[model samples]
Target: MGGGGTLFTYINKSTSHLIIPFEIAFKYEEKGFKTADAFIAAYTEWVGADVLVTENRHFLACHLDLPFKVLTAGKCLNLI
Candidate 1:
């Protein structure tokens, strides 16, 4: 949904829920912002909810510097 090097922030006011889902369809290089991290930060700020990121273990580990727990789920889950 965004170009490379562009940092975006999204906020949800209804509830406290942060979810980050990365799709395999998109090609990812070993550079730039990992979709997981971006989603987590944005979700956390918007909803003030905990973050849930479901993606390949390797990819998630490479991008996330903070502590995170992996969950088994699809990438097309509810975004907000």
Candidate 2:
């Protein structure tokens, strides 16, 4: 996940027409996990994008707190 974030940052900075897809990991069903909104919230703040896509259903439900639209699936082709 760290690698994906790093790559996204690099690609976004390097290319002018690149849309970076960021993954928000939710440890909701995992042990000792309280919040499943960390990654989405952080990335929304970090990138300031217009939209965010995730496969997790809980993320979409809790996306009202975020600035971007939490989509289920979308295209983000990295030219870099």
Candidate 3:
């Protein structure tokens, strides 16, 4: 963490290998967000974002195998 700040900016955005929101809408429902919101969340996870900035605490219910971190909007800003 040093004085270099967060390396979150180095995160990648996946154009391919992204989950199809329509194809797996039902599975996202288990996370408590609507289909549209779930799509965004799913994309965030697929993109390998360093942090999934969200105001929706319901994302905590997402049990998907995630490789990134999740933070509230405020928390994300603080890190920046």
Candidate 4:
């Protein structure tokens, strides 16, 4: 869910899976990370995403509870 910037390969995918939050307050309450990261995790879970593509170190931390499989952007490139 992290490749929204490069519109070439992901616009349609995002549009199809978009999950707009009906409520934002306390939506993503994970600590030790940015609000965006927490929200991404929550939203990914809400939308039933199987994989989360990103290179963020914080997301890979062992202490985090990430529901989806986390892959580096480079790793996704290799897999594709």
TM-score against native, each model: 0.28, 0.43, 0.51, 0.57
Give the clash count for each candidate: 1, 0, 0, 0
Per-residue lDDT tens digits for candidate 2, residues 1-80, read 45545324321654444432343434322322235456445445556666665677666655365556666664444322
Clashing pairs in 4: none
Kindly report which residue pairs in candidate 3 clash with one another: none
RMSD value for candidate 1: 14.0
A best-first ranking of the candidates according to their lDDT comes to 3, 4, 2, 1
Candidate 1's residue-wise lDDT over 1-80, tens digit each? 45654222333453444333333212232345466545544444344334444565654556444333344356424432
Query: For residues 1-80, could you state the per-residue lDDT of candidate 3 as single tens digits?
Result: 88977657654445656555564455566756687766766666555566676676566556446555777778777866
The 10-residue segment of model 3 with minimum total lDDT is 10-19
Residue-wise lDDT of candidate 4 within 1-80, one digit each (tens)? 46665422333466446655635314555345467776767666666677778777878765345566888888787866
TM-score of 2: 0.43
Q: Deviation in angstroms for 59 in model 4?
A: 0.4
Q: RMSDs, each prediction?
A: 14.0, 11.9, 4.6, 7.5
Error of 3 at 4 (Å): 7.5
- Model 2 worst lDDT run, 10 consecutive residues: 25-34
